[model samples]
Target chain A: MDKVGLEKHTSKQFDADLEDVRELVLAMGGLVEQQIADAVRALITGEGALGEEVVQGDTEVNRMEVEIDEECTRILARRAPQAGDLRLIIAVAKTITDLERIGDEAEKIGRMSTHLASYDRPKSAFYQIEMLGRHVREMLRDALDAFARLDSEAALRVAQQDEDVDREYEGIVRQCITYMMEDPRTIRHMLDVLWAVKALERIGDHSTNISEYVVYFVEGKDVRHIGLEAMEKEINEGAARRRGD
Target chain B: MDKVGLEKHTSKQFDADLEDVRELVLAMGGLVEQQIADAVRALITGEGALGEEVVQGDTEVNRMEVEIDEECTRILARRAPQAGDLRLIIAVAKTITDLERIGDEAEKIGRMSTHLASYDRPKSAFYQIEMLGRHVREMLRDALDAFARLDSEAALRVAQQDEDVDREYEGIVRQCITYMMEDPRTIRHMLDVLWAVKALERIGDHSTNISEYVVYFVEGKDVRHIGLEAMEKEINEGAARRRGD
Candidate 1:
């Protein structure tokens, strides 16, 4: 083939590979989000079958994670990419790990659901768990969208949303303690709920991690654990400068 | 200078930079280990002053982490190193983050110790808390040693030791619950101890993370969360094959 044809073919191959990886990541994210939603729903609705499916489905997420990792390794070895391309590969690699862990957390919630469902009537705090799940699910979606678009602002927002999940987790824990104190029989069962809620909170943390990766990929900086207020202030100041405020 | 001389000079410069980074990591590790020791000692002796010192000294570890990160960034930008050099830089960058978090956990323990010291006779299983601290402190040191020498075997061992720390933490929490039930007055104080012990367990997790990074740097593969039994089986099989057994 002519040099121009060769160059064209190589760029086409690169684009195809990038798209393949993007699809894999989005698929993995979708599966993880589904897992979290189903796990929480299973607990709230006492659906044993749904909980079992979430638990069993985690193996598939784990398998996809290994495959994605292998693909990233192969791309890095063969493409010798630099700068933005390198950042994209690293982001996908790191995000997949976070996604897989989120899957595990969902599985944990599912397993706990099987145990907690046996309770005669769950403490009213099931509503809090459901709300926490909704918040984290939204964060996961936003984080993934930010990653797909390389949007730093969206990623920052997702990170900010994590605090709400954390606060809800705290409230649930306090409520569980009150129930445990009211009746000793509630101790073992309530502890399971506590663990499950803790796992869900950690899932929110992993979503924050995904957002941090999005920020890293887009800005080439680590903005993790820095308060959302500071992040918003900086971003708002930059926008104000652009608008001559 | 001739091409050969220039190449030799550049190589020496790379080696020197690598050593500088390595030495800094070791210094950070030493401080982290000392912080763990001081935190434990404060707990055992009820030394409020020592606990305060540990909390105050954590600022140094955080500053060191930033310095190490900056150094790694400069090396990567200036040298554009490959393979082993790349791994060394990446390991240092990641290990410092783990070390800094370890420092934070130790400070948390220190703060808890101050509060516990004020309480009249720590009613819970103080012994189990001490045991948890000892096991985690040992894990932290062994992880640092493994990383310093790039010893994959040592890293694997450190990962295995984490399970021991986890079991100790479980014991402490169980004992705390019993104490809280016996005397409601001790409830809040015992909960604080539980949180501090949980922090130590988390610090052990950070040590596991460091050990996993060491393994990755040395072997170019991730084996995190893989059981020690599986690692032992792999090693035994490799040994048998080498001996033509």
Candidate 2:
């Protein structure tokens, strides 16, 4: 092939490589989202066997993280991509770490669910775990959607949910302690519920982390560890400047 | 200056940048280690005041992580380093993340310690949390030691300790359940101890992740998620081949 044609072909290939990894990330996210849903369902429905399935499902999420990471490393080494491409690679690298940890949290919930199965309950999810679980699941789904669309504004909105989740988490902890203190018979059961709730709280944090990476990818900004208000102000300001607002 | 001299001069500067970032990672690691120690001590000594200090100390660890991350990103964008240099930068980027998370776990323990303070304990670390905390602390220190020396061998050893930590964590969980079951009043306090032990277990996981990054840096192998046995065999075999053994 002529030099121009060869150059164009290589660029096309690089785009394809990037696209492939992006799809893989969404797939991984979908799997993780399911894991959380299933694990929480198991906890609520008293389906101990389903909890085991969720535990096994983690292997796939872990596999996806490693696979996505290797692809990013390969692209970085071979393409030496600069600017936006480099940031995408870095953000994907960071995002998958959060996703993997989120998977770990899901697995922990799954394990707890299995243990909670034997402890007879109302055959419905605890009110607190259900509430926290629903909020966290939504956050994870929206976080992945934002990444897929490269939507920084949506990422910010989703991240704001974390504060509510934290409040819910704290509420549950206090409530659990009250229950355990009132009746020692419920101590074992309440403790298990608390563990499930703790895992849900962590999943919320990881979802927030995923949202931060989306903003990082789209805006070329690192908003991590910064307070939510500051993160919001800077991103909005940057957007305003770009729009000549 | 001549072209060759200019090339050499730029290379020297690149090396210095890499060295600077490496030093920063160790500094960050040292700070995280101290946070864990202080947090655990607070729990054991019933020093609620110290626990608050440990929680506040986490802000410094978070700041160091962001600073280190920015430096690494600057190097990557400007240097466009290849092969070993690129690996070093990427590994540093990843290592600080685990260190930051280890700091988070310490902060969690700190928070739990503060809560446990009011419950009136024996003025000694609960035997379970104390034992588990000591083991995890050693692992963090050794993981940092391995990173400093680029000693994958040491990293492998430290990573292996994670299993023992896991077993100890399980033991403590069982023991805590027994204590809470037998004595109703101890439920609240034992639950707090459980949270502290849970945080220590996660710290072990984060320390193992740091060790995995060290292995990645030295061997250019991504040993994460692979069982420890596989990680050990590959690293040892690679060492043997390098030595023509």
Candidate 3:
């Protein structure tokens, strides 16, 4: 083949490899999102069986993470991709780690849900947990979607959503404190609620992490270790530049 | 210059670059270790000023993380290092991330210490936190030492230590629950302790992550997503095989 033919072949192969990584990542994200939703439902409905399913489902997420990581390493070793391609590989690798941890957090919630199912619960605390869970699940969904689309604007929106989740989490913690203070008998069950909310809060954090990776992948910038306000400003400026283009 | 001389020069340059990255990582590790120590001291002593210093020190850790990451990327792009060199770079990049997160967790403990300083004391709770914090700090130190020496065995030892930290964390949580149940007024103060222990537990996790990276760098294996029992078994088998040689 001529020089152009060989160049085209190499580029095509790199594209195909990247596409494979993306598909695997999306599949893992979809599984994790379901795990979060099912875990929350199990918590609210007091269904231990569904919670068990979420816990069992985590093994698959873990497997997907390992597979995706291996693929990224293989590409990096074989192709020695540079610039945008290197950034994408790094982002995908880091994103899967976050996804796997999200799955683990969901599994923790599932376990807590199973434990809580055996106890007589507080109605208001359960309601707050359900609401917080819904918010975090939405954030995860949006973060994954932004990653799939390479949409920094959508990613920034998801990052901003974390503050709302944090607020809701604080509210739940305060309510749990009140419940425990009013009736010591409820302390044991309230502890479970507290732990579940902590897991939900962590899920929100992992989602924000995913959004940060999306920004990094798209812009090749490291926005981490900076304040949220600075991150938001950077994302907004990137969006404006895209519009100007 | 001849081809042989050029190859020799390139190898020397690569070694120098690797050494530089390693030195930066160790320096960052030292800063993080100090942060953890200071944060724990502040938590136990109820010195808000020390906590503020730890929080402020996180900026330096963050800057180091970014600089190290950029250096890794530059080396990858310019050197196209392979095999062990490639794995070492990847491990350093990933390890620095976990170290930065450990710093963030320390900063969180610092902030909680600042807040809890304003509250009335729970003597026994503080004691338990102190014990747990010391264990986790030791684990961080061992993990960093393992990385610096490229000692996979030491890394495995550090990974094993995380279980003890987890058990200690659970004990602290249980004590906090009991305190909250016994005295309604102490519930608020106890919650602060709970969050700090939670942060400490997370720091242990990040420490485990660094250890796993050490194992990966040495053995070229992925031991994560697997249970600790399995990881220990793998490391032991590897050790046994080495002995047979």
Candidate 4:
């Protein structure tokens, strides 16, 4: 429930700069989340134009990343941010990189959707993909919420969803491979589906990365590469101490 | 011809810290490069043991990334570095992320190699994978060299190799799809090879990121997502102006 304390700085402009950058990140995240949903919907519904739109929108995403990066560097140079502010800047840098990558993956899915548009919709696998897409979109949303609120506990919860997404991805891949074996004619379409699914799995990973950054920004800990249980334990222990305080 | 100019710092300890970090990044790069080679070799040669070793060694790579990250953060906090020093710290942070990702790709290749070991060596596609692996490995090595020497020009050259790697990867994927159609019995093995090749392609991408980081470090320009030719033009213009200087 702790929000990022934006009003602590004596310099109101510094607080405004941080707030503006934060809003920009959330806007970027919202756009990326929509892209993932649209790309997945395009794939399932065989909407080629929607897919193309998603691809075109990626340029905007790239532009935002560059703009935000420059803003961060400017803040760093002018402010020489320390302590929590420095961690916030670093975390913002890492978060935007993951968001931009999520945009790229969504664009890939969009391309795959256009290709899949030419083929008959494979109902069963497409359903699984839709489900996976929904899972990751929620994960993305919740991670951004955690970031906005400085909710390390919520971020930890979001991080755990990654395992479920990964398992679902594997099951889908196995099913798709089985389809390829049974019907040789479906190889091209199935492979496209597999690639699209792979992109979804990677989106899940980037979501996990964003949540980790939330923890890093809030807790001032580098929780990357650590296993889920350990991350959870560390976050929970920190929460206990904070509650005691 | 330009080094990172570590000697510019007023504090001798700050200069020494920068030099130490630079060396640490190079050492990490060296380990990652070897991991890529061993992983690819294990895939091509069906050395499951070697693949396992590569997979196990990833923890060490992850450890290096974490250690280097802490060091960079410490330097940033302590030095409050300005201009080139700030850029160097930021670029180092970004570079370690890419290198860590390259290591992750290598580990995935290792896993795929272990999976691919059960089947007979499919010579043709495996050769393509090997060549593609070597191509990316070179890109990575050249990128690290660019970082060490602050050679933006060399970095641009390394960036160009990514396209060739991408083309080769596509060629391999297409050929593998043909193989899967010709013989469904080879589906599992061919898919494993395809995944490994995908890993190789991603390694190329990470290499390109590193090269871009080098360019950023040397020229103080954000050249990413700008396309290969545009990046070259910008770097060339920088070099041209520097020559006049």
Which candidate number would show the highest DockQ if scored against the true structure? 4
User: lDDT per residue, candidate 3, B1-245, as tens digits?
Assistant: 00001012357778888889989999999999999999999999889999999999999999999999899988888887787788888899889889988999999999999998877777887888898898988888999888887777888899988888999999888888777777878877777778888999999999999999988887678888787788777777666665674
Cα-lDDT of candidate 1? 0.77
What range of 10 consecutive residues in model 2 chain A has the weakest lDDT sum? Answer: A1-10
Structural RMSD, model 2: 5.5
Compared with the true structure, what per-residue lDDT tens digits does model 1 show for residues A58-136?
9899888878876865666556556666667767877887898899889989998888776765647988888888988
lDDT scores for all predictions? 0.77, 0.85, 0.85, 0.91
For model 2 the local lDDT of residue B62 reads 93
- TM-scores for chain A, candidates in order? 0.90, 0.93, 0.93, 0.97
Ranking by lDDT: 4, 3, 2, 1
Task: Write one digit per residue (lDDT tens) for candidate 2, span A135-238.
Answer: 99999999998888887888998889999999999888888777777777887777788888999999999999999998887777889888899889867876
Give lDDT tens digits, candidate 4, residues B1-245. Answer: 54344438668899999989999999999999999999999999989999999999999999999999889888877788888888898899999999999999999999998998877876888888889989999999999989998999899999888878989998999999999999998888888888899999999999999999999988889999999888988888888877786
Residue clash pairs of candidate 4: none
Q: Per the 3 Å backbone cut-off, how many clashing residue pairs does candidate 4 have?
A: 0
lDDT string for model 2 (B54-167, tens) is 999999999999899889878877877776777788889898999999999899889888998777664333766788888999999999888878888889999999999999
lDDT score for candidate 4 against the true structure: 0.91
The per-candidate TM-score of the B chain, in the order shown, comes to 0.89, 0.92, 0.92, 0.97
lDDT of 2: 0.85
lDDT per residue for candidate 3 within A173-235, as digits (tens), equals: 988888888888887887777888899999999999999998888767888767678887877
Per candidate, native contacts kept equal 0.00, 0.57, 0.63, 0.69
Summing lDDT over every window of 10 consecutive residues in candidate 4 chain A, give the lowest-scoring window: A1-10
Show where candidate 2 strays beyond 4 Å. Answer: A1-10, A123-125, B1-10, B123-125
> Who is ahead in lDDT, 3 or 4?
4
Q: What is model 4's DockQ versus the real complex?
A: 0.78
